[model samples]
Target: MVTITVTRKSQSFVAPSELTPSEMLELSAIDRVPGLRHTVRSLHVFRHKDAADRVASRPAEVIRAALSRALVDYRPFAGRFVGSVVAGETCVECTNDGAWFVEAVADCSLDDMNGLDYPLMVSEEELLPAPEEGVDPTSIPVMMQVTEFACGGFVVGLIAVHTLADGLGAAQFINAISELARGMDKPTVTPVWARGLIPNPPKLPLGPPPSFQSFGFGHFAMDVTSDRIAHVKAEYFQATGQYCSAFDVAIAKVWQARTRAVRYNPEVEVHVCFFANTRHLLTQVLPKDGGFYGNCFYPVTVTATAGDLAVAGLLDVIRMIRDGKARLPLEFAKWTSGDVKVDPYELTFEHNVLFVSDWTRLGFLEADYGWGAPSHIIPFTYADYMAVAVLGAPPVPKKGTRIMTQCVEEKHLMDFKDEMKALF
Candidate 1:
């Protein structure tokens, strides 16, 4: 097993400027979703191939200074999430309190950390910073950690209160920090808060998700190679008379295989829920300012029977997923205008539910902070059995797809792997 020991060096609250006043920003209805109230973390590891010696000397100071400047425009991150019960509904309060920053050192080289065979075994808590006990999490929506390794390379881990931003929004903030580190006067994209853009649902659903019998759980990585993706696209075109994206192909396959792996009863209902990006998808609905700095996508669910999914052809599954996504525009309109009556509670996870999200489009490798882009961007968080995170392949080949799934049974995990390889 690979082990890393991290020693805390310094801790502080970094504000954009000494004169920046404290203020409160309200969170959107999407941000206040039940499942999304917790913190979401991103782990970025940069290996300094040539300047390790120079970087090791002042890693903390460099990142801290950059972060302070980056917070100037993204001041909301330096605030807390305040909640109040208004007429039986939960409302969010965002108050500027300064983001928590921690500096640490690991007694290992970047090579040593990366050489582990089972990457998930490494302890995530030691790498990322979190809110201290007795301190309210909402008070510090953003927290960061800079860990210097013995080999001169370093790791940057960030945890943001989900109420503050989504994954893309978090990337924007990090990129801004990187821009400042590289001596840029300002970020490439301006930050904007538009939570009121989407109105709350008219009614909230009160119910627990369906239940399933206990079973084995495992995490597996599936590769969607360039050639394999091309083949799938071609097959989809032939069968459906249309082209589908790599994401469509990959998600359909996983959803199909998972139904079989878990031995879900043929008569049981199953759902594949997807998180779609509406930044560009709903150009007519969103303001022309471009993707705002908050949760912009909606969780859309598609339903089918386990037996149906198990037997359905790939093209059909692809279309099913694609068509479900295509309806988001009308859904968004209905949702914003109170025509739709749904709440986050209704989207809870269950045995028959499989959630799929695509992170491949986000440029995780491009946050260049003077020392070039990161070599590895790993999600050190554990996923439950009913979830799939679709990410782009490593920086090298740049043509394949990578996925990390949560909680599959031991035997089913192997079968899932084989199924994925067979699809390619």
Candidate 2:
């Protein structure tokens, strides 16, 4: 494992022309040219365990470096780097607020934030919700904010534009930085755009997309909240009584039940897309240490039905998701991993309602920024029926484990709660 040291690198400012091809690619990645709201999607929040103690970690320094590099090209476009203008993007500076952020840097990691107090869990309504105001054409690609916390650990807030990549992609970058912070000579993976290898967006036929007004101008979107996380982690078992991962079994049973209900789509084919971390996939194979720049993880897209997800066994669901990952290099993986490799006008398709697997997919949840691990990590709440995930909480003496989830609507959410109680 190779990691870069933040302390060793000069906090130097370099023009884009001065950068290597790879560096330039990274710089360009942040440009908020219109149509790439993902370039500004706000996903992922980071927590430091011991506040001040983890500040010196090389990973933290590297993150700062990356930010500086991004600014070289995507510097504040008239006050902000880039974002949905209709929604009003701004680097809203703040000493403190309830916004959920990726990084929360503060001058002092206060002592009062010890345990539950600092990692405050409020109602879901109070958490960061997706922008309701027309995806704010000017929504800042990066919303930088810092504040003092009761705990010694300072929080750094970074909200990436969601159109570019999802939460899974953001997590990969963070983990890579952690590797560097630990002083690894080489990073785990190198990012590759590989755009040339894929097809253009809308590869064939298509239709007119909904106008901005059709999306309710992004105002009707609900806000995400911080309801305390709760879940149960268990291993999968076969009929022979052999044990498997709880995630595998849970996914299997849920989707399996759904598969039995709906007739599988023959033309488009219904499947589950599991987003896996690809940082280690290619990087681990390298002999030298280096930074992997482009987004690496390949989305796992397994075909199934709504009924399949609702009634499949844990092991089966895990198997389906894992299998999709195993075949990333396949043509199918490229078409549906959320990359607009094919133009939407041609396919008339978008990832229709993502059923995300949150709890067991990502490793390093125990990422200790020196203070200690986080008490919890919740899923994005801005997306309606489409974006859903089951989050896991840290172990508490009495609670053991817990899970978080999003539903299609209020009724489905309540139904799920009922199902969970009956099953558990």
Candidate 3:
């Protein structure tokens, strides 16, 4: 196992320059509807290279300057959350309050860290900026940490308020920072904050519904190689005479394996929820270029019983997921303020739920700062939910996807590992 020694260097705020817009940015209905109070966290690891002498020597100064410039365009991130729970609207105020930024040093080299089969979760957290004090973290909206390793490599950890952006939205923000760092004029896709584009929902209930309450779950990770994914897709095609997407197959397998791993009784209910991208699905409302940033995906959920899943074949599961995804357009069409009555965020993570987020298509590998594209992108943590993050690997020998998951039961963890390996 690789060990990491992290030393926090500086803790400060990075505010936008006078050039960027200065005003309060309100949360859209999509952001406030679920009343979810958590940040979506991500990590990007860059390997040390002799060529990256500039980045390694002054990592903090370079990143801090770039972040300040980037914040000028993404000023909402520099703002703090102002509205209260009882106020009915919680908005982000762009007072140029600044995002919490941290700099750190790690003990091991990039190879030493990646040498392990699974990335170190403990070290990943250390690379993230500490949560803000005095005010709600969401107010800060975005927090970041850049940690340089002994071998010249470094990792960047980010925690963004989900109310602001989903995976893609967050990627867009990072890409902008990267572009500025690389001396580009601006991001290729300028962020669009047409919050009204997302239909507003009626006043939400006070807290997460009873069914959405947290359950003690142990987190774990399972690696899925390109070969394994291809094998499953081939199996699906042969069995059903129809093609299946990598995501459809990978998610189905995890759902099936996890259901069986836990040894749930045949009649026990189970659910699989996917965060489906709606940028294309809602073209009528969204820009064709899909340049509009903010949360644009909807959670598409399918439910079953342990017995039902046990009896179902792989094709059956794929079809189920397909159908659920196909319904997003209709869901959006029928959406209204009253739709909050069935808030998807609550349904997205109801107890015992298997929530899968596919980041393979999100272009994380292209997230290049001045140094170069990240060698590895890892999701460090998820709040109050058991999640499986499917990420795309960098351009390398293996050319595949990596599945990192939050904890489940101990026995189930072993079973899931064995089951995933057997798929190949």
Q: Of the candidates shown, which would achieve the greatest TM-score relative to the real structure? A: 3
Tell me the deviation in Å of residue 373 in model 1: 1.1
lDDT of 1 by residue, 219-255 (tens): 7775667898898899889887888998888888888
Please give the distance, in angstroms, between residue 290's alpha carbon in candidate 2 and its true position after superposition.
6.5
Give each model's whole-structure lDDT: 0.71, 0.37, 0.71
Displacement of the residue 274 alpha carbon in candidate 1, Å: 1.3
By the TM-score metric, which is better: model 1 or model 2?
A: 1
Which tens-of-lDDT digit does each residue in 4-102 have in candidate 3?
Answer: 678998888888865566577777766764444467777787765555447444666777788898888788888777776444477777788788889
Clashes of each: 4, 114, 9
Alpha-carbon lDDT of model 3: 0.71
TM-score of each: 0.89, 0.53, 0.89
For residues 1-424, write the lDDT of model 2, one tens digit per residue: 1221111112122222223222221212212212334433222234444445446543334444444343322222112232243232312221111112233233223233233231343222222333334644334433432222433333333455643334544454545444444445434555433323322223233335433311110111111112211122233333324444444434443344333322234344455444454445444332234332333344455675555455556555666666665676554334434454443212112333335455434433544333444444444333432434443444222232344443334424444444444434
Q: How accurate is candidate 1 locally (lDDT)?
A: 0.71
| RMSD to truth, every model | 3.1, 10.8, 2.9
How far in Å is the alpha carbon of 62 misplaced in model 1?
Answer: 1.5
Range of the 10 consecutive residues with the lowest summed lDDT in candidate 1:
85-94
